[model samples]
Every structure is written in structure tokens, then in C-alpha cells.
Target: MSKVLIIFIKNPVAGKVKTRLAATVGDTTAVEVYKNLLHHTQNITHLMAADKFLFYADFLQREDEWPNEQFIKHLQKGNDLGKRMHHALEQVFLNKYKNVLIIGSDCFELTAAIIEEAYLVLEDKNIVIGPAKNDGCYLLGMKNPQPCLFKNVSWSTSQVLQQTISICTREHLNDCLLPTLTDIDDENDLSVEQKIYFKLKKSAQ
Candidate 1:
């Protein structure tokens, strides 16, 4: 089946991204961390064979790591996170793709292999979800737009994953769950080896 991968990201703007992390490490450091996360996402997703789309929070950037010709870039629509996501899915589904998956850049552990596996699972199931350790989901995949799954969601809370599953159950949509991974949100969320906050201290000055 034809597949599409949607990646949601913000252009690395200091004081504008990762607000929680910014609170702990300051805006300049948060921007750097987000930049690193975006780089990691680009590297991991570069090898995938499916059609890829980068949904930007603001305007598009052509000079970034993701070559303009390689991934289709679009600005995210709607007023809230859930609405934006639902709109993207609706638009993609209207285009007649057989399988679609959306992921955020927050999960550093996400890999191309896991993404491929989600697409594979979509061959049988209508939905595939990768649960995050924070009770939020890292990745969500589906064959068609199921708008109910995106509604009434408590974004950024510990109940996100559970609420999504409950909606799925209510709708009787067949689904498969992937392994859980941690998404960086707070300063404590970063692994010691990945700590590059020190690098931003000088720039912030």
C-alpha cells in the first residue's frame, strides 16, 4: 500500500520552542537542544522509502538539513495541536494514501526501523501506536482518518496515551502498539551523554 510519513517540527527559534525545557535550561539552550533533536530526526528518517512530509509550526525553511526536494514541507494548520494533527490526516487521507503515520521530533529513540515496522503492522491493523514513557504517544499510524481518536485528547499530559486507546476501543478500530520510548520535555529528561546544554551558555550570554 502507498504510505506517507508526517513529521511535525518547529523551526528552531529561541524562546519559541520547548517551553518547558526553556524554563529549566533557558531559551537559548532549549533552542540548541531542539536543533539537535531535529537533526537526529532528519538522520533517522532519511532512509525511509515512504513519501515524507514535514509539517512546520511556522514558515518553511529551504536551507535546512532536509533538502527541499526530498521531503514535502507544509505549514501546520488549525488552532490547537489536536486540530492541527487531525487536519493533516484529513488532507493526507483525501489524497488517497493507503497508510499514514505522524511523529513528533521529541522522541530521540525513534529510528527508521521502528517506523518501518509501524508501516508493516498497518498492513493488517487499521492503527499503530508507539507509546511514550510519559503516557503520551510518540508515533501514530493509520490507514484512514479517524477523527475521533484525535478529539478530546489531553495533549502534553500523562493521560494522553490512555485517552487515545480508550477512544480507539470505543470506535472498535483494530490497532497494534509498538514499544514505549521516552520523550524529552524537562532538563531531567535528557540522558547524561546527550547533555549539550553547556554549549548554549556562551551563546545566551
Candidate 2:
């Protein structure tokens, strides 16, 4: 079974990435912070044993200078947030990966071990979710593509996680929830980045 990691990212342009954080930290700093988050995610994903890693970006044609060899970069398709994620997952599964996991670039606490755990959970569970502290989800995994869970989801809101769970229940899909995690979306979430940075800095010494 091939394990796949799909990272949904945005062009870390000023005033584009981390809009909420931008309000607090200024657009330039927010973009820098967002870039750090993306780097963190890329580093962790590279440490995993996945057969394929897909970096799906919002703007298809806008090419920023990211590390090319880090992952397979692809432009995200679909109208809304939910649809884009669904489309990306569907394409990856259609291409023949057995276990696929999708994640965002904002979770500073995401580690190789957590990703490995999600892959393991997918061995027995149809759907796996790593819930976020803000009532959203940082990671979602599946044995195969299931579009229903991503359909009609209220994206960018507190109801996201609940709506996903509701969809799972409505469709009778076997689901597993991993330990709660945090994503850097607002001013409060900035602490997560500091903590991760300091932890890594200490470990490096």
C-alpha cells in the first residue's frame, strides 16, 4: 500500500497567506511566519516514508521559489476550499495511492510521528482526523478517496470539524480522531510557532 502525503498550501505572498495573523503581526511578518510554517511542514513530510508527497497550491500559475525537490508541486483545483481539497485527494487516489493523507501548512506542532500515526490509523480506519484547537482539523487521512466528507463543508469557520464529523456519521464511514493539534490562524495561535521554534532550537544545540 502506497502512503501519500498531500500538503495544501497558499502562495506565501504578503497579504495573502495568514490573513488573520497579518492583522496582528503585519502582512510582511505574517507572510514570513507563513513561510516558516510551510518550511516546517515540508521538513516533517520529507522525514516520513510516503511514496508521494503532493504540494497543492492555491494559485496554479503563480510560481514562487520554493524548494523544488522537497515535494511534487501541483496547482489546486476546484471552486471552494472543500472542493479543492476533495479534488486533490481524488486525483491522488485515482493515481493509485492506497493510503492518502492531506494536511495544511499552518500546524506548527505537526511531527513525523503524528503523520506516521495517521498512516497507521488508515490501515484500519476509513477516515482519520487530527482535530485542531480552533475546532478545525489539521490533518485528514483516508484509505481511499471519499468525497462526501469534504462536500458541503463550511470552510474557514469553527463549524468545520463538526460538519466533517456530521458528514462521516451521515455516510456511515468508519472514522478515528487523533490527538488535538493547533494551527496558526490567529494572534493566539502565534505562540504555537514560538514554541515549536524554541523546541527545535534547543534540540539542535
* TM-score of each model, paired residue for residue: 0.93, 0.88
Estimate candidate 2's alpha-carbon lDDT, on a 0 to 1 scale.
0.81
lDDT of 1 by residue, 125-165 (tens): 99999999889989999988898997889887999899999
Off by over 4 Å in 2: 60-67, 192-205
- In order, candidate lDDTs are 0.88, 0.81
Supply candidate 2's per-residue lDDT for 161. 96
Instruction: After the best TM-score superposition of candidate 1, give how far the Cα of residue 171 lies from its true spot, in angstroms.
Output: 0.6
Segments of candidate 1 deviating more than 4 angstroms: 196-205
lDDT for model 1 comes to: 0.88
Residue pairs that clash (backbone atoms under 3 angstroms), model 1? none
Question: By summed lDDT, which 10 consecutive residues of candidate 2 come out lowest?
Answer: 58-67
lDDT of 1 at 124: 97
List, residue by residue over 1-205, the lDDT tens digit for candidate 2.
4888888888778888888977866786677778788789877877567754565565553244445565677888887888888888888888888788899989989999998999899888899999999999999999877878877788989999999999999999999999998898877876765846644654554
